[model samples]
Target chain A: MIQTVYIIGIGLIGGSLAKDIKKSRPDITIHGIDTSAQHLNEALELGIIDEKTTVEAIDKADLIILSTPVDAAVKLLPMLLDRVSDFGLVVDVGSTKSEICKVANAHAKRRNFLAMHPIAGTEFSGPKAAVANLFQQKTNIVCEIEKTAFKLQEKALNLFASLGMRMRYMHPESHDKHIAYMSHLSHISAFMLGKTVIEKEKNERDIFDMAGSGFESTVRLAKSSPAMWTPIFKQNKDNVIETLQEYISNLTHFKTLLESDDFEGVYKEMDETNYIKQILNGIQ
Target chain B: MIQTVYIIGIGLIGGSLAKDIKKSRPDITIHGIDTSAQHLNEALELGIIDEKTTVEAIDKADLIILSTPVDAAVKLLPMLLDRVSDFGLVVDVGSTKSEICKVANAHAKRRNFLAMHPIAGTEFSGPKAAVANLFQQKTNIVCEIEKTAFKLQEKALNLFASLGMRMRYMHPESHDKHIAYMSHLSHISAFMLGKTVIEKEKNERDIFDMAGSGFESTVRLAKSSPAMWTPIFKQNKDNVIETLQEYISNLTHFKTLLESDDFEGVYKEMDETNYIKQILNGIQ
Candidate 1:
């Protein structure tokens, strides 16, 4: 049984994990560390974590979760692993995996670290955005799971299972590539769409009055925190660029069809994409 | 009092209007007409309409509502107006307005027709998707309202008010232009995002397993019916193309920042767009 846990970057994902763990395992002591003192205070006030701590606290904990933005995690994971006790386990809950995994690949304590991506979140961020059961029924992708020590892997699996997550394993490279299309690209598309509309419609009231639920849904990701996302795009630059190119190409082709008044072509494209309904239903 | 109301193209918007009117003003008879006999049958069975009738039955109605696809509405609005009695009122709830209004501009009974677009609906379609109070608390854009006779305008206002809608008036050209930025472009952006992801991720389960609420919201418009949206894109081609160009430019600029690792620039862009949170709140 785990006696103590230390969660770094105690924002949405970290705070939420702490809440679920605290509920399920009351005997465990959950401590929080964050670069933002404001977030740390919020987590403590909200009872998401039992105490405030620092990297120096790693020696006393059985598990350490690096839940910072991807760039920060890449820089911090190896340094944190160096400080972990022999039996302590370290795992990162970042969106991108390739850079984080590569930075820690040859570290002396590499076997103590696990690279994970929990496929769940809201557009909101920070500790206040954390909620109970945020990870329930969600998919958790562990990249290069085989690189971790067997005992550490077991501990990570048990914790995620307790949070009601289904785990999938993939190579670091594969995880980054797949997520570029599925998740990161969607955020960029929404951000760009929001930027475009705001630039064109100078009268914000016109947009507020005229836009419908469809527009609301499509641009919802524009509200995401930039501090969290900018690092993600930087870390996964190549795959994101490739996905953006494909997305722009598709948009241009659609524009051409609209320009030429090819109604049938537009109709056929939307009809084909309608199959996404079935895929989305599967997720629900 | 509206003794009878005839709704053509009895699908989502039309069927929903029928349902709302029946609840709020049951003294009026609600009749539905659709090229799709299946939709007519469903609307009747759901009690969204009192009867399934044809254009031949339109002369007896006190009001006529054309809620067909824009292309079909462009053709039928003029023909339907030609058949309306002097005391009868005709209005359209099509997405695009310029083309439909232009086509009927020279009709002898131009004063009998009102061009309108209700700023509401779910991604779902067909009569089965109809909901009472769908227009409640929603804005309704009335294009070329002055072109309709004063009596007909008052009738349209009364019905929309009874259905709990706030009305805004604009010229047909302005309506098409503004909606292209506020609504049409959003749908295109979502459709292209969905297409790009589906094309790249051949394994559908990967997308299903990994996509979170953000991706789901961004792509929700992708599930819209092609039959409904295709004509809208075709009718508003110029404005749609212009909006698409602006959207593509924004996306390309974002991609360039990502390519150069300009994290600050990326962050600033999203930060500015975060103003959308206030705008969306206003919508709610």
Candidate 2:
């Protein structure tokens, strides 16, 4: 009589969810599917799920979770629409929501789908990157919630609540815009900073020895997998562009202040930005 | 008799150097000096130095260490030039070099002064921020080394070696430029990124709670002391500005690629930047 939950793309988020659910909720039987056989095998080995399932096995599940990369989520969601049962609930934990939501709009089981983005991840990826309590105390933003079936929304909210996540409701487009500034821009800045330093410091000795935790922390995401980010960037292109433009303009103004030897102005600029401490306080 | 070392403005860097020297060479007596009684008291309580000294004490010591903020270093060097004994060696560990180096150029004890920057620090600042191994295995960039007397150079090198730091030599101007890209730009990007996110996610609860280690790493420097960074930006205004300019331009180009939905181009950009992995490997 247990609820059957099937997960697509059993990587960090998916695998972590499976592990937590298996540990916390005895009545939920979890099924995991991944493109990588290694990930599937590891998920089984790690007891991340009760069993491994194929695409054909998805039809029997009462709830389906898409934890794949953004592009892959688009392709996988359509295939699952036909296989999902009448009572099935479907959700995706992709960074970009608008495109995926649009792609799934015409599906037969469109009302069964809920778009979700759990605002959590590390620079590291993969099933091995999965950790217990990964979603604990994190925020899971559910977009276009009104479009989802009422029963499915209730089920999804209850599941997220059990996993120790608070929820925020937003439209799909708004989620993409807000996330580009809060998340995507941060990754781009970190990556390019790493690139700039790496390009200039011809000898790796300089970066390895001279770069401190500050540089490492700032550039940590530069080490993130290209497979994951390439699609998110493509899907959230407009918002990312807008956010990056603002970021770049700010940097240019800062540069001009420095170029003019405007010591007071430069100091003032940094001081103004230091207000971020207050902003962080607000977010926390 | 053991050498007597006078450390002026004994804060984090100064206090740490004092601690290291005390640990390495018990025979060497370390005297601390600071305009701030609070810092002097904390340094005393921490046993970072043997005793507190006045400006007049510079003449009696075998070596004088300038460990204050950049502004303090600039103003104090002229006075120390007149007071220090002829055989005494003086070293200033300031973030910026050209300004401090230029001010000390015509001093009576010009050869007695060595302009050095230890490329090591933490987000914390002040006397309490001092840690025993802060400079261990780090790179210390010595600018305009040819300007320092041979005897003084030898003494400075030995002291840095005892502290377990490798050394790199560069002209003061070049050091500022290169470090602008590597160090200064990193801080600016971090501060502003923090600002942007805080601004956008004003009322979003648990926004920071959802921020995994990646966000923390990128924004770590945002927690740095405003007092410390305010002076640095003021002192290195021109170089910091120019570096910020280049960084912003690069970010703009990235934003353009993302906006155009150029997934392949985005993939290539990130992959190219990942070369930093090889660069980072050399540093550690």
Best prediction by DockQ: 1
Pairs that collide, model 2: A208-B283, A208-B284, A209-B283, A217-B217, A255-B241
Stretches of candidate 1 above 4 Å error? none
Write the residue-wise lDDT of candidate 1 on A168-209 in tens digits. Answer: 888888888889988999999888888988887765466569
Top model by lDDT, which number?
A: 1
Instruction: Give the B-chain TM-score of model 2.
Output: 0.96
True contacts kept of 2: 0.62
| Candidate 2 off by > 4 Å | A1-3, A26-29, A45-50, A146-159, A203-208, A281-284, B1-3, B25-30, B45-50, B144-159, B198-212, B234-238
Q: What is the TM-score of chain B alone in each candidate?
A: 0.98, 0.96
Tens-digit per-residue lDDT, A105-218, candidate 2? 978778989899887777767888888887877778888788888988898788777888888877888888877877888889988887677666666344355565567667
